[model samples]
Target chain A: MQIYATIAELVSAAETADLSLSELMIQQEVANSGNSRDEVWAGMERNLEAMAAAVKRGSTGEGAFSKTGLTGGEAIKLKNYRATHQSLSGDTMLAAVQNAIATNEVNAAMGIVCATPTAGASGTLPGVLFMLQERLNLTHEQMIRFLFTSGALGMIIANNAMIAGATGGCQAEVGSASGMAAAAAVEIAGGTPEQSAEALAMALSNLLGLVCDPIAGLVELPCVKRNAIGATNALISADMALAGLTNKIPADEVVGAMKKIGEDMPQTLRETGRGGLAATPTGIKMKMRIFGQDRDFE
Target chain B: MVLNYKSVFDIIGPVMIGPSSSHTAGAVAIGHAARKIFHAPATTLTVRYYESFAETHRGHGTDYALVAGVLGLPPADPQVPNALTLAQQQGLAVKFIEMAGPSPIGHPNTAIVTLSNEQRTIEVAGCSIGGGTIEIRRITVDGFELKPSGPLPILLVWGAKDNDQRIQTKLAKMTKIMRQQSYNTAAKHLVEFDLERSLQQHEVDSLQQGAAELVYL
Candidate 1:
């Protein structure tokens, strides 16, 4: 059986146990109602401004912004997907995404169904929702609520720990995202926060040491299309959570495990190109070639 | 019971990937954000996915997503992976590489989406977080995390007086508008507006332009 007496108890435990969740809730705003949302927004804005200031101080450099020109080239492809979905009006957002990706796009496509987030990860939520929606079509509001729920979970991960490749490794970023998304999916489908947290704990517990090492360092290499994979995992986690298979360990504990794993990771595997696959000769050659440091340059 | 509406689950998942939603979906979101931000054709580009993306990138279809993104593919595009091969076949010289070390601490799925021509490189790092929310983290051309999620249709105005304050104010106004217009409703507008503003700001150009790009699988 679970340890908590109620959902509030579980959330409180999570909040106290983790920084991300606590921050996401923005503890200062105890007042309920619409103002809470505003407070969240304000908190986010303040963080953004502060981050900007840090970036200016040269504290935070370009993490992944180096590949700007690629987006322009990708426009035509995305447009086609959008066109197909738009034509299929009145369809559920999940279906629209699935259909769009299935028809026009290429290497891989995944849908985010019940607890969807970024469009890149769009398929994950839709994919889950599609399967569930066919059984029971929920409204758009429900979908949004699912996302909000997921967002709440995501904020926890984002705050208390790491959602970046450099800090927590890839597991902390995508793994955390998938966990939150899974929690959201289950919640939207009528699961409880215990279920949501369980899903998150399950997801994170499984993906403890994922690293963030993009091929070529471009979002495209494994970045943009990884949504399909993220989506799939989100569904898997959601289903497990819904099924009542909870992680005996709390979600916060799992996050702690993740952070410790990341900290213990070698620099090469820590998105630093010093370890893991990045240390391969091929990787070295590739790095040289990409940076114009290859033999040809000599 | 007050209906604890949190989307918590008891048993969920065989989650797809991790260490980054930004590196994954956030990246695609960035691609889509770019399409909406530029609303123009992108002829030349230099993409970089960090270490995680570079390693197992083929499995994740980041290549396809970037190509599809450049071509204006939606976030939901299935051919995101195939788009890269398609683009390569088209002679776009869509190069790929692995980057080293962490550049900054914002969103992990950070990419400098530069809408450019031979004359100018209007670069921007589209920071896509979970749920398709994006922020123009910074512009390489001019250093500033001017919120790009606004509907004001303003330029980055590099070095413009009160640019930061202006952007912040605009974003505040936009979020206010979105909240007022759809208070009870979940605000999709906020996400879109935020991305739009980030895309137009061209923040990514300032830092990682012409550098090695990485992708994680």
Candidate 2:
């Protein structure tokens, strides 16, 4: 089986085979690994199970503080707020925000999480998928298929550009994850592969050049909230694509631009804990406190 | 079976403990891969972190993750957070070094570790590039760098130099070899095999009894 490194090639292959993007990805896995379809599907099912478990444990787990005590209870706070008050983002979007935050909370607490492209940006996909499952009443198979769909596009990003924050910044981490979630959303909502591509481009463009700076160098603060916003970003992008909207630039070019931007980014902005939020007064102070360092920044 | 494309699992899986994949899980993977390459229990372990790995080791739990790996814990093990205590209880004398900023040595997420048993001391260096994926940069045992990449279900077999034909003769008796690549370096011959599946421990034990220096799954 030939590999598709770009959105155009992937869509063309999907159309030629008359298969949904999810099915094409499943086929690709079976071909590459010499595994039966059932085996490949079962593998993705395990990932889905892990992701769902993270979501559950994150929301309900007690003493949720991260090892650093920097990020912990925001997801729980959101859930409580949602139950008592209406959100401007609406229930589905807020639900996505809730789940995304919850999942990252689990990650920050050193709990197990499926790296949807990466652990740093792990929450966005599940944020959207679990909310969709609740809203659309999707079958277990549909939930698993959503992962295969997103994972296929994520591989393209990983190969062509990258999904690493160190190499590509948050644009590549949460940004790519949001784009993957958007594409998967379109497909699960019965949109064509082409529409999913547009959705991906829109999602990437929305968060282009986002840096990967965490206060104290922890996956707390902006990183956790970023997932919440990333979930909403995917939701809005999917809606636009499903509503017959499209970006002027192709999806592949957006990924390319992300790569170039990340390359041009300074080392400090790329997970070095030296710039962006990590360089701020409070961020630096917190870093000193957490690490017990006395090297005061003049 | 050198795949030109990555599997989807490469993107969506590797369920791991994390505040950061490259720092935490990647460190665990590096430690675990080093342990696998050693193929023996280690007593004294010295770990050195470089660049971003050094800077964020405290917040990201890179220290615990690396210790967890040296202790033979998998990347996702919940025991990772308790690794420092666990290592002490297990009588593993562990030393961790975090390099100061801007050293001219390694990638952002790099780990250079030396593990010694009573008889042998081995050095392994690995880089966690991103997304829970890692590249094993160097290994002291057989210089596992000549051919850095291969198909999965791989085995790095250490033996005498130019022993490919001899190892092949030995390996064929065990299982069909889909593909094989070998290089002789640092007085060690390393043969990488794309096998039908991961070899069972008994099978590896039987193979190690041959002239093979070490066999790692």
Candidate 3:
């Protein structure tokens, strides 16, 4: 059997196999690895449980402080504020953003987290999934299905483009992550596989050319905040796709474009901590303050 | 190369302790793989951090994580941060050399590890290919490349001169071998094979007494 390398092939495979994207992924896992479908689902459920636990631990405000004191407490503050104030984005979206922040904050604090794609981009999928669980009243099995759907899309992107910041900047990291989350959210919201692809395209296109420049070379600072933004982007893009929106460019083409942009990007911008926000004067000051002195880097 | 996203866990999680997956978890995996290939923790170790890893490994906890892995700690272990001090108290001679530029093989996140004991020396080159996934590009023991992926149980049988008949006949009886790779250098003949099941301690000892060494990954 041929493996699906592009979104079009994936969608067509799902259609011909008479499977949803998530089902197609489950089938592929069985065929490729020779594991039973139940085994694969059990492993995914374990990850889901870990993600939920991280989210809960992170929202409690304790142990949120990162080593460098860069990121912490924002998730707790967001959760606390939502209890008393009427959030313009409403409770679900606010909770989604907070959950995303909480996951990354935990990650920055050296806590365990399920890296949705990578640790730096870990928060987006869990944030969107848990919020959708409450807002849509999704069952645990449905949430697992949502993960499979997202995995299907992420597989295509990772195979076609990249997912590491060192390889393709933040666009490939958080951008690919958000695209995966958006597509999964669409699937949970009753969007077709094609609409999920559309959501992925829109989410990735919006984050194209985004550089990977964490201040002081830590995954904190802008990274934690980027997960929050990525979660919001996933939610909005998913909604847009559900409401009959489509991308001008196809999903595979968008992935190819991202690969090209990453190739063309200067080495400094691709997580070298030499350009973008990392190069600002304040970035240098923070690095000096954190490390106590500057080391030689030529 | 086609990136393998075999399972949903590959996409969603490794559930690791981290600041960075590529730097921390991946580094640990490489070191752990080195330990496996060495079969025992080395008394002295030399690690070369190349390119981006050399520049930013400190901030990412790559150094401590790699040492923790060498001590046989997993990525999720909370004891990772104390690996440096632990290595010292254990009396392991550890040296870190910062290479000037990208590796000659050209991966940005690459580590070349040299592990040595009184009896043997092993050299392994590995790269952290993001999200706690790694590729063991090359492994050289006694000047022959013994390529093992580091996840499977591999028995390295060396010093058997006759590769065609003697080694294969013996290997066929020991266990069911899934994959095999062979290399020949000046002094010895080496064959590495992944077993369907792990060998007993007696089997390992028998293999080691007969051949040069037996390594189970």
Candidate 4:
């Protein structure tokens, strides 16, 4: 019951056990937590159901405005636009983007969300999972397996590197989420475990040093739109890995690099709303507008 | 560290009501833990919000969530936003003091909660480490440090004037004790026990009537 600390070890364990990454993860969960496989699957299925419900409620444009009135209805707008007009990104990608936005919008509006790694980046995995389910004609069980695969990757990152924006940054929140989703997408597409790791590396490297700067210190504003971008990043990385693209650095090394960068980052960049876009003039105006004054935040 | 992720739920979901996981859910968890430590509803409470939590907790609903937690509401409870009003109606005198600068413990999102009644006081400090998970960094009853985490049942016994053997004899009957630690100062003796199975409510009340405090983690 030793914890797997790196992608290489997890892949090796999967190979030795003669199981896929999702199967290995399920086994590990049963061993570590004393839960039956059926019980674990039931729990994951519940989360999947909740995520689907959030997506449905959010996409319908039902009370999406957050408390600060910053971000709302953008997901519905995207869904509507995709319905009437042809998007250059195609229906599958557009659906991923829309679902991602929808989930995060629900989160901002204080609706329940399944935090894929964290609530601030909750949208990416569910977005890609539901979209690919339709496009690939995947079953419910397959979508559950995809969540298991993503969970395995997320566990490794959280154990070895970081996953909290306060501890690392948005690079740790959305970036880790993007990596998890990309790896899951690779698994759903029938790629090897190593290929999935490559997808994660590619996805994370693209988002290194990303800050957690929510406007007015709310999880609305850029957070909801960023989930859209994170989902798109996940899909693109998954496609590249499926097409035989590889990262120059190993996935473990890239995760280490992310941890190092997070450590070196100033406090202002790590969820304090003191730097990045949160410090912009528009950001200040929004804060003033929401709170009715320039409150002494710092 | 053991990297405490035992299931996929810890990674992909807590299925919580939230704007920020660390701020809202984690804050609720801290308050929940504090409530458990007190063994009864806190008649009076003082909560200290530190650093980033002090700055933006209102926006994230951390303030409401923490109050809801102490009122025995779960993180996903819909009434969390109205917890303060509920606390007022319940006659729980709660006060919040926003502390400037980061905690000495270094986590940006931290809270120290003190719960008290006419006879006793307990203080607990906790950090929400994202994704609705939390760590109980410190706990002090009187002046002795006690550590408890998760949902296990805990028993704390402070002997009268160093009468440690009297309490140890009483604890011998509890089934499936997971951990036991003891602390001693000049005037008092403290023994902490963590159990696999929770003590019955009657058993908890019996212990409370004595010199012991039974806490459910």
On a 0 to 1 DockQ scale, where is model 4?
0.44
lDDT by residue (A1-298, candidate 2, tens digit) is 3557789999988888889999989888776666679988888888888899988887874625687788887778888888999888687788899899889999998888999889989999999999999999999988988998998898898878877787789999999999999999999999999999999999999999999898877888789889987888998999999999999999999999999998899988888788999999999888888888832311
Candidate 4 residue runs with Cα over 4 Å from true position: A294-298, B147-180, B185-216
DockQ of each: 0.05, 0.46, 0.42, 0.44
Off by over 4 Å in 3: B145-181, B191-217
Cα lDDT tens digits for candidate 4, A1-298? 4467789899888778767899989888776655679988999999999899888878984536687778888888888888899999898898998899889988999988898889999998888998998999999989999999999999888877777777788999999999999998998999988889999999999999888887777888788988888899999999999999999899999999999998888877777666788889999888888878644533
Total colliding residue pairs, candidate 1: 148
Q: What are the clashing pairs of model 2?
A: none
- Taking chain A by itself, what TM-score does each prediction score? 0.60, 0.97, 0.97, 0.97
| CAPRI class of candidate 3 | acceptable
**Stretch of 10 with least lDDT, candidate 1 chain B:** B2-11
Q: Write the per-residue lDDT of candidate 1 for residues A1-298, one digit (tens) a residue.
A: 0122332454766566753332333332222222455554443343223222211221112212222222222323333445575644333333323422321122122322111232223334434443444646776445445544555665455545655565566676557666776776776777766778888888778778877554434333344334434545667777888987878998887877887887777655655444555556765566656555421100
List residue ranges in candidate 2 displaced over 4 A. A61-63, A294-298, B1-5, B100-106, B142-154, B160-163, B166-188, B192-217
**Cα interface RMSD of each candidate:** 12.5, 4.6, 4.2, 3.6
Cα misplacement distance, residue B14 of candidate 2 (Å): 1.5
- What's model 1's overall lDDT? 0.45
TM-score of 2: 0.89
TM-scores of the candidates in the order shown: 0.45, 0.89, 0.89, 0.90
